[model samples]
Target: CTIGFGSKAKNIVNEDMVLAKVLRSQGAIPLVKGNLSLGCLSYHSSNIIWGEAKNPWNHDRSCGGSSGGDAGILAAGLAPFSIGGDLVGSLRVPGAFCGVIGYLPTPARNSVIGCLFPTETDTLNSE
Candidate 1:
């Protein structure tokens, strides 16, 4: 799996993210990083590095943003599941566009220990 270059990912972090660790424990091995919005904020999936993420159902349609790659990959049957940050429908929009399940867990149920959300924002507002 190839990951897109989202701005947040540019920050150097040697350790795996908390989500990655949790997934690994369940026997999920992340193959590679997937595409994402430029700044992790966009309704479209286009980026300079990997280009635009298109809907599998229709080439011309958008697969949605930020998590578009995740939805695109899932829609294409590449992976069973994927993790994406959702702030302003980043995950749900793509999931809906791609005709997949986009679940937003309650803030208290999920952890954001290794995430790099904007400092001024509340992690609870995201999924």
Candidate 2:
């Protein structure tokens, strides 16, 4: 049961991303460019990069931003596994709130992998 959320939610970032590779291999879909997403145009948010992500655990609490939609789906149990990018705490923040794994794969050192199998270890490892 996959679900998505946001005000101006675009499928490219969330829903489509989940199936992009498979769809591409099948030639059933076209490649779409990801948004630079320089910033959010929301006036209601003080953060200014789109409003804060709504915490399903407690709607008044923040989920995370930039990748809020991804977090929301995860928090709500919309999907078993999901993908989200991290320029900041976008991934970690939601994972903490939703009780799931969040990864930050680094491209250095011949591809740095992280959070793929997040454990209490991640919390202890962070410095």
Candidate 3:
């Protein structure tokens, strides 16, 4: 399988990301990785840093964001599963656009330690 992260936070995979560690422990192998916008704000993945991640269905269509790359990879059959974050439909929106399944856990259900960006602060609602 493959894994993708929101560009707003940790763009690269590291040991600090708990979900990556958990998935590795479960025997998942990292295959392909995709690109996203700089700060997870853009709908397209045409960032200068990593380039664009296009929709598998149609090159002209958007894959969605900030988890757009993740959904795109899954839709293209590059991976069976992917890990991504959401703070206002970041995960769900991409999944819908790509015609794949997406899931977001409740804030209390999972830990968000390493996934948080440096500028992030505790809020009344969790992203």
Candidate 4:
């Protein structure tokens, strides 16, 4: 799964986020980890990764961010599904670039109480 925050950040696991918790309750297994832009801070760059996540279709191109890693894994057939957080297009951009289905619910439609950085309050205007 592609975690939306940096690995060093607090509460970076799926269990810490409400959406992931719900998914886990429904029988989802996180098999692979994907890289993301630092602190969900950059959408145009993937430089924060240990090794940047490249597009599955074209290794020279970006897989998109901050959820780029999730999209990359999905495109590479490493994961059946992935959960990603988006403030602008973290989920959508990566999915589009990777040629997979990506969904971003309205801010009010889901709970983001435990998501790292860019908390629900931080993105109150995004909806």
Please list the C-alpha lDDT of all candidates, in the order they appear.
0.74, 0.44, 0.68, 0.70
- lDDT per residue for candidate 1 within 1-127, as digits (tens), equals 2234544346566787677787899999886555777777787888877888888999999988877988989999998888766667888889998999878766645566666672223333324
Give per-residue CA lDDT, model 4, range 1-127, as digits (tens).
2343345545434445676677788988768667887656676436433558888899999988887888989999988888766667788889898999778755566665565544653332223
Cα lDDT of model 2 by residue, 1-127, tens digit: 1122243344333234323455457865442211112242221112323434566787786555444555566667765555544545656655665566667654231211332223332221222
Candidate 2: 10-residue stretch with minimal lDDT = 35-44
Which candidate achieves the best lDDT against the true structure? 1
Each candidate's root-mean-square deviation in Å?
3.8, 10.3, 5.4, 4.2
By TM-score, is 2 or 4 better? 4
Q: After superposition, how far is residue 5 of candidate 3 from its true place, in Å?
A: 14
Give the least accurate 10-residue stretch of model 4, judged by summed lDDT: 118-127
Ranking by lDDT: 1, 4, 3, 2
Q: How big is the positional error of residue 114 in model 3, measured in Å on the Cα after superposition?
A: 1.7
Those runs of model 4 whose alpha carbons end farther than 4 Å from true positions after fitting are 1-15, 44-49, 118-127
Q: For all candidates, what are the clash counts?
A: 5, 0, 0, 0
**TM-score versus the correct structure, for each prediction:** 0.81, 0.45, 0.76, 0.74
Over 4 Å off, model 1: 1-12, 118-127
lDDT of 4: 0.70
Residue 102 Cα positional deviation in candidate 3, in Å, after optimal superposition: 2.2
**lDDT (10s digit) by residue, model 3, range 60-97:** 99888877888999998888888766666777888988
Most TM-score-accurate candidate: 1
Q: Looking at candidate 3, what is the lDDT of residue 65?
A: 80
